[model samples]
Target: MSRKLLLKAVEQAYSDRRRLVAPLLGFPGINLTNSSIKVAQQNYIEHYKVLNALYNEFHPDAMFTLMDLSVEANALGCYTLFPQEESATVLHSSFDESRLEFMNSIEIEGDSRALSYCATVKKMSENFQDSMTCAYITGPYTLAGLILGANKAAEMTLTNPELLDDVCGTAYEKIKTYAEMLTSSGAKAVCVLEPSAVMLGPEQFIRFSAEYVKRITEIYSESDIAFIYHICGNSMHLLEAMCDAGVNALSLDSPETGMDIKKACKSAGDNIIVIGNINPAGKILYGTDDEVFNETEKLLNETAEFPNFVLSTGCDLPQAVPLENIRAFMDAGRKYKLP
Candidate 1:
């Protein structure tokens, strides 16, 4: 399908409150068994079938690639081990800043896993050709966390600003390359997963993360592919900086970032979409279906004035989230129509 049609369907589905099912569509912090992860990789066709079944049951309009963190990090010199019955974990880093000179010389694609991720993008494109398939790229800031260690990166932001710049720059280059690969491989949109930027104050976020994000989005600005920036914490302070980054969409976790996002988008005169503020863990993951439906309705109603909003969890749905609860989200989307 054309990218135009894909986006239109997504908008229509959301507007009419129709369900749009996308696999690995958004982050769900829920853990999957190693076996499930392996199964997802080895039998994608089969996995697509399962996703289709869910979509059929729920009547969602789009599909997303299964969630996997191995792609970008592994490409940039991180190792991930998928445990059979446990959550996948990063086992090691290829470059450590303590040895800054050595890390600087390590090229992104020079790492074997990066090549594998490029291949995965091709495979996923072929697998989800009929639906709107979104490819995930680690946000430069988030990738910095993986490379420098979240705690180390946070500390360096204040104590060693230069080091923070070096680390973020290196990771941004790698993520930009990966984003290009995914877009070329037919991803309808690229979701920049920047959960860590929320940790910084507004000034720090602008200094450290905003420019890198802008750099990435600028590369894809002329393309039909969408650039989505997801900041998982209370980013009310950095909302304008994020909007200025030139993303096609801004995803926030709840409680609402308020009129700042609406005002920022207006100020920029850019048609950026807004997504999510639902409590993925608390409401969607563990709450009753009724709770999910009610909360979703509340969010939709509150954001109804915004034409480009997409309803979604504040973060990823837990791996073991009740399928029924997920269905409730879709159901609520279909039930709430804009006036």
Candidate 2:
């Protein structure tokens, strides 16, 4: 599809009388298929099974691929761990500038895991025409954090800003290339996950994370590919920078993490979509069906007045989250009427 048709799909979804329900599901959905996260991450057929399972059961307005922050780092030679049933995790490595030549020389699209995700995106576009297809990319600062250990990345911020800036420049280029791969593979909506940037104050966040994010979104400025920016923890102070980053939407954390979703939506105003606020680890994971329904309905009552809001979990649900709980969340969202 051309970019205009993709933009039309999203616009029609948003304009519908009902609010769109799209949970940031990845591993939890894999449980429906006879597959593990490790297998799905490595094999495209297995990944499409997960996507099919989620769409068959929950029928979200949009479908997001498995959320893995390790793709770019793993492609660039960072040490990564792949648990049998969990998403891959990148280990902290000491930043050594001498290694930049080798890392920069490596082509990320050649990576097996990166290729698996691209194939999954292409499959989603081909197989699932009714639902919007979305994917995730590691944010520049987060990728830089993986390149340099988190503590070192933060220390270099004030101690050696020049070196840190250079590292982030490398990260920005890598992320841009990966973005091109995903977009070319047929991902209509791509999210830049910047979980590691939550620790920095607003000023540091804009300089280290948001600015590069702006540049990444510029690649599709004329097309409505739905660039979404997501941070893992509370980002109350960084809402200004987040809204100014030129993304079409913001996936915020749960109120339990000290993020007031109502306030976040107000800050986003009418232009940007607010995709979340439900605690991934809260009621939906531990409470009864009634509890999850009440929680979902309560959030809708509070924030559905904003036409741009989409009902979703704050972050990806854990693999252990019971399937019945997800049904409860979806049931609540589907039953509610938009204000």
Candidate 3:
């Protein structure tokens, strides 16, 4: 498929005031009894197979890479605590002034789940080249938090700004490399998940998080591929900073951030292509079908004027979310009319 296809599709969606649905559906499963890094690598094919199955089953407007934000952190030498049935978390941070000194030399080589992530993304692109394919990565600051410990990393933003910025730069390079890999495999865009940015106020975020996020997005500015920025938590305050980062789209957790999508976009002008605020855990995962439909219907009604608005969750959908709820969410979007 032509690279321009996705760029054109998005452009047209905005021009026509046609809302597109691309929820962050990247879960491998919710029922895994055991999901060690070893098990994932050994059964990489099966993992991608399940991912593909979900995509086909739901057939969302767009598809994203698997839910594995820890892959890059693990590759960067941070130990991960893989859960029996959940996404892995960064268990140990392997960063310090010394580690930062040689960060430029670090590469995601052998026996790394980062490689598995790339392989799965490659296969997804190959299988769904005609559609808009996206790859997910931990945003620089978030990855830095994972590698340097969230509290310590946050403190560095205040006391050791230079060191934090430097470490974030290291993460920037690594994320850019991962983005390149995904694009090479067929991803038309990359979504940088930076949930940690919410830990800081807008001023600190601009310096510590947004700056580095911009660096990664800038790398693809002139290219056909786009970049989408997602920050978990209430991001109403950082909407301007996120837009200034020059990402093609800004994905927000509406319920968490208390952001009125249309209100924020109006203040942000027409450039902000907002993606979400749907309560993934609250409504889509645990709420009744009527609640899910009402929320989806409400969001659609709210953002009907903004063609740049795409309906999606505030973040990646949880593995345990009910498939019936997901279908209900999708159905709501499909059933809405632009009257």
Candidate 4:
């Protein structure tokens, strides 16, 4: 854990003025193993095959588990749909407060699929010893959204704010338990995915998301685990608020969403590593190899002044993203040097 870590590796790379390249190579890398999304995510053996295959193909600096947002909700007894080729998702519905009480009684670690996620990381640590072993966990506010339904959750924020807080506090407890399990399974870092938080304004975002995230960060600070706060889409307006969460890193979306990558790097300062700006579904998927290479090199150069930075995608890449494009993107990272 001490040596196969994130902060030290990023700091060393920063001092050397080198970039750590770690795309959110989740479902797209499944092509490397010839496995379906459902099978690979539920079975640790299949999951390892995909991740190990990704490492063999790209040899990126860090290895991330599949970017599935539904695992925590499914573990809580929510009605989740598992398509053979896509990530599982919780169905939208109204829920009762008593349901949260019922879900609280259900053990999160007891869920077989949730346990498989830990096993997937366990397998990663055993094989990808030299690379950073990163895992993704549900953010408490986002999990509360799953429990209360997205629309209801947002409405509750304005109407019955207390009710939303109650649900969020309970959800935080569940996410914390699952996070501890991932840590025990040997995860060096965990990214708190809070895609739903995009619906909240700065103040509400802090109250619902960042505050709980800060506590989670404190819990793992003793173990030296790097906690990254990742909210999908254009979180440009919420960047400073996200920084206040006290995590080690912040992964942002592409500039297509009007996000200013340079300003994000400057705002995070030295405490957190700024990762990403490349659109997962952008040039890397539809453009030529040269285009992919140019875009990556440009992004690397734009944020080059910040030592605490990593080259990554704004979100998880699609499973069909051309392999040659990923190769081209990695090529840019490998070839670039700070000017």
Candidate 5:
């Protein structure tokens, strides 16, 4: 399909206030492999299959592939291994300051692990190009957690400010590079998954996370692809900072109140799009399809007239979430009409 047609499809969906579906339909506990560095090579194909399957089954307007978070960290020499039936985990925690220091020299495209992510994104774009809104994940501060150790990194934000800059800066550059690659490969938008950003106080979030995100946003501002910042925790305080970071949209967790988010957005002059606050774990995952639809209806009503709003869960849908609930989400989107 032509680029114009692809863009038009996405635009029409947004203009009609249609909720675009993402590949995050599976639950968090679902298995993600990390057997070897070489396994990274196959990450794209494996994830693509899941996405393809989901697309075939549901036929959503858009889709995304789940790449292991440790992809970049693994390439940077961090020891990470995947366990059977469990998500990828970092086996070792020691940050080689030397590696972090030389991060600027690292080439994101050629790095073994980073390349795998890029390849997976490319394959998704190639296969689902015109039909789906392709997406890639860059778990921002969470990536920092893998490299610096979450506790130590949080401490450094307070105790060693300079080092924190280096860490975030390095991670930001890598994420920016990866984001560019994904867009070039045909992603309509890239979601920066910054789940750990919520762990910091507002002050710390501003100091440590905002600028890094800003740098990336600035780089992609003119591109056709949109940028969304996903924070899977209470993000009330950092809402403005996230907006300032140049994100085109925000994805909030179910724990966050939609009223609070709307208020914050209003205060920020409604600068960015708001995607979600559905309780995926409690309501969508465990609840029945009717229950899911009811919850979705509540959100749709509450967010009415809020341009650029998209219905979604607080975070990625868990693997164990009832597929019926997933269908309910899509069904609601299709059935919804503005009054």
Candidate 6:
């Protein structure tokens, strides 16, 4: 499927008040078990089947490839711990240098896990040709923190700025190449997650985070593949800066940041697709079905004026979140009455 079709569909939805409903669900636990994370993630067919079932059930306007942020980090020499029925996490860097000297040598295409990810994306692109199939990757700052140790990465941002810059810059190249691979395979859009950027105050965010994000977004600035920039935690303060980073959209977490999506819509303007800030764990996982429905309805009502609004979870839905809650969230969107 061509990238233009998905954009056209989203654009038509935008003008007609048919909000695009896409939860940040890559691998729901309902179809997975407490087995090795690699086993679950590498099984692309299983991943697609799970997503297809959910899409069939909910009929989302968008779907995505695996949501594991650790795939690239692990491929780039970060020692990762893949738990049974849990997302993969970085245990430590396989390399000792804070500069990430190993990045130039890391070949994501040759890496087995990366290959599986691309294959999954290709298949999804073929299967969900008419809908938006997005590819997910870790952002430079977050990947740098994983490699240099979060605390060490933070310290270096102040004490040794050059080292952190070099490391992040190198990580960005690897990320860009990997994203290109996914796009070539079948991803119609890309969502780059930069959770570590939240720890940086404004200055550090501009220096260490925003610039790299801009560079990555620029890679697709001319292409048909859309780019959505996401920073976990309360990035309320950085919303404008994120907008300046030149992504097609900005996704924020409302509960974590205490940010109003209306403000983000204003900051990002009508051209940017603003997605999410729903409290995935707090509301979607623990809250009752009524609570989830109310939250979703409230979000829709609050941002209904924005044509580019997309209803989604603030972050990835946890494996434990009940399918009933998921349904309620979608139902709320479906049943919402435009004011």
Task: Give the number of the best model, judged by lDDT.
Answer: 4
lDDT of 5 at 124: 65
Over 162-197, each residue of candidate 5 has an lDDT whose tens digit, in order, gives: 887778778888877777777777677777888778
Model 5: weakest 10-residue lDDT segment is 28-37
Please rank every candidate by lDDT, starting with the best: 4, 2, 6, 3, 5, 1
Cα lDDT, model 3, residue 337 = 67
Query: Residue by residue across 96-142, what tens digits does model 4's lDDT show?
Result: 87887887788887889889999998989888967888999999889
Q: Write the per-residue lDDT of candidate 2 for residues 156-250, one digit (tens) a residue.
A: 88999788888888888888888898889998889899998999999899999999999988778887587889999898899999999988889
State the lDDT of candidate 3 residue by residue for 233-318, as single tens digits: 87888888888887777878866557677776675565556788797778788898888999899988887776567788888887
Q: In model 3, which regions exceed 4 Å deviation?
A: 1-7, 14-17, 28-43, 93-95, 109-111
Candidate 5, residue 161: the lDDT equals: 77
Q: Tell me how many clashing residue pairs each candidate has.
A: 16, 0, 2, 0, 7, 2
Per-model TM-score on C-alpha atoms = 0.81, 0.95, 0.90, 0.97, 0.86, 0.92
| Tens-digit per-residue lDDT, 251-328, candidate 1 | 667675342434533543426666666776677777899998898888677766666666666666656777778878
lDDT (CA) per prediction: 0.65, 0.86, 0.75, 0.87, 0.67, 0.78
Misplaced by over 4 Å in model 1 are 1-35, 38-59, 91-130, 256-270
TM-score of 1: 0.81
Candidate 6 TM-score versus the reference: 0.92
Error of 4 at 79 (Å): 0.6
> In what order do the candidates fall by TM-score, top score first?
4, 2, 6, 3, 5, 1
The alpha-carbon RMSD values of the candidates against the true structure, listed in the order shown, are: 4.2, 1.9, 2.9, 1.6, 4.0, 2.5
Q: How many backbone clashes does candidate 1 have?
A: 16
Predicted model with the maximum TM-score = 4
